[model samples]
Target chain A: MNNQFKKGVLDLCVLTILKKGDSYGYDVADTLSGKIQVSDGTVYPILRKLASDGLVSTYLKESQNGPPRKYYHLTDEGAKKLEADKQEWDVFTKAVREILEDEDK
Target chain B: MTKKEYLDKLTKELGSMSYNDVKDILSDIEDHFTVGISAGKTEEDIANDLGDPKALAADYKEGMDLPKILEKKTVNEKKPKAPEPTSATVCFCVLITVFVAIPAFFSLLAVVLTIVLSEIAVALGGIALLAFFWTFGPFKATGLLGGLALIALAVFGYALSYFAVKYFVLGTKWYIAFIRKTWHEGL
Candidate 1:
């Protein structure tokens, strides 16, 4: 995938993941990088940006082993944004797919 | 690259960012490394998967809106935000201005006006004496000398009044500025 393409949707992806449930930085990075061809380091900046934007709120929870983990929770604002952005993404991808299929025929 | 090497590069690449911002970024990365290591990944493996330190720093700089943050910091440094004066401070300033400063200023103003009026009267008196010098028939010499002396005294008085008025105006300006400063920043 193009770096710019991945960067553009990275925020949406991170927000969707947080929408599922609260997760820490490392967990979000692992989950995102598992599916996307991106560096594990990329998620931190996105998480930071989201937190700063008030889309996500973070709180530290004690882990079973090691220091407290900073878990990110999706705020109401973030959920609303995710709903709109997801709809836009679906519409955009469907159009692109139809165009590509037409070319193949 | 090892964790230490990765973090050092990231920190170096994040040059000129605020200390708190840099510290926060470094700590986050450090936490990532710690988690990765616990998850059975070697430092080198984790560092490679995280990609280039420079690129990661660039992403952080971009994502954090560095330009806006840096601009805000520089503006704050250039001109520290003035603290709002409390109600008590406003009351104190008002009281002082009304009871102390206003009265003092008016008194001084009256004194300056008196000096000015006295100087003007003296100058006019000197002129009148000079104009009526011919009327001193027998005491012509006395009248001439007295008129010259009065004119000299009036000239000196005018100079003195000029300085007093100038200083009085300057003092009023200074007092106004002081009051404004006190209004914005208590005491």
Candidate 2:
């Protein structure tokens, strides 16, 4: 995978995870890297940027195993942003796919 | 690398960010390690999977720098430097400084001098009255009483004068010290 393409979708991918449910950074990373070849640490900075941009808000929740864990949840604005990003990604990937698949035609 | 060593390296590479921000980042890293450990992964595997701390730090730096760039741009656009102080402005500043200082100095000097002179006059008057009562006998029988009262008044006056002089001397010393300190450092 091209690093540029991964970097480009990382934000959307992160927002997508939060769009599903409020999850901690580790779970988000796990869910994300399961499909994409993302470095485990990359998700953290993405989460931080998302939070700073008001796309997500974080809170501390006690874990059964250890101390409190930070949980990130999407805000209303974040949901809106996720929708917008989803639309943009759809259009972009569709266009790219059609162009790439043109050879089959 | 072990989780602790990896986290410490990451923290060090992050460098000089806000405490809360650094803590947040470190917690995220810790969370990753914890989840990895729970998933039966080794510390080395998790650390290796995270890639370089320096590169991770650069990603954070990029995100942090975005708003900062926009802020700097807006500030630069909004603010224009005022014209440099002209010689006329410098002259006016000096004039105002002297205008305020000269009258203030003279008034303070006049007040202190008046206090000292009045105290000296009171002392002199008390001594002269005592001497007159002792030498010339208006009432010889009451001479002792009058003399004692005058002597007490003279002592009180002298005490007041002594205090005034001491206060003036100490004030001048403090003023000199303050001025010297400010000169060496700045106002």
Candidate 3:
């Protein structure tokens, strides 16, 4: 699979996860790292990107032990884009899957 | 490797990004590990899941396009430039432009009028320049030129503010201080 395909999906996956509800930066990294391996410190840069572009808003919430944890909430803009990206991705992936299956035949 | 060793490796690899950016990203990774541990994953388990620090840092090194990553750091790099021209700069600029340029452009008056108002503005500006020096016009301790320029402005401003005040009024504080010292000595 194209690495671009994987990379594109990582952002969409992040937006998708946030679409359900807000989550802290670490939680998003951990959950996504389980399904697809990311680097030791990759998720943060993505979170910062999404945030600086106005796709997310971060707020500090009290943590169990240490300092207040920053939580990333998907903005309305992010949610709308996630819906659109979901449509585009599904169509794009389905077409690619069909092409691969035809090659198998 | 320990977390500090891992972060040091990341910092070494990502020399292009600011160190604070690298530090924030490292904190995010540490957060990932902490959350993973809470969820019943071992240190090794979490570490394995986080593929490679160098490769990940490369994903964020401005604009690195690989097979699967968007790597759009430059796309977000302009956020830090917002605080450069703060309010003090704006006010100081307005003060200088209004005070300096308008006075310097008085060429339309007849010979006598031109000499008089031009002399007045120039003379007053020159005196203000002196006071501007005495007051340490700008607060820049590190900027020699800026400090000097602002000191020039400070004199200009003082001349502009108190240009017409009589020498008697200006010396009142000195008189009071001298009287206090003499009277205290007499007592």
Instruction: Give the local distance difference test score of model 3.
Output: 0.65
> For candidate 2, lDDT tens digit of each residue in B77-124?
666654565565555555644785456556767777777677666666
Error of 2 at A99 (Å): 1.8
TM-score of 1: 0.59
CAPRI rating of model 3: incorrect
**Ranked by lDDT, top first:** 1, 2, 3
Compose the digit string of candidate 2's lDDT tens values, residues A1-105: 899988889999999888889999878877888899978788888888989999999999998887778899999999999899889999999999999899778
Instruction: Return the TM-scores of chain A for each candidate in numbered order.
Output: 0.96, 0.96, 0.92
Candidate that scores best on TM-score: 1
Candidate 2 lDDT score at position A62: 92
Segments of candidate 1 deviating more than 4 angstroms: B68-187
Q: Which segments of model 3 are wrong by more than 4 Å?
A: A37-40, B36-45, B62-187
Model 1 residue B47 CA deviation (Å) reads: 0.8
TM-scores, all candidates, are 0.59, 0.56, 0.51
Higher-lDDT candidate of 2 and 3: 2
Q: Give the Å shift of residue B101 in candidate 3.
A: 65
Q: What are the lDDT scores of the predictions, listed in order?
A: 0.89, 0.79, 0.65
lDDT string for model 3 (B1-187, tens) is: 5556666776766656655776777777777666767767776766665656677677666433333333334445555433344455555555544675335323322333544455456556555655555477464343444445555665665554444334434444554564444444431
Residue A82 of model 3 has an lDDT of 84
Better of 1 and 2 by TM-score: 1
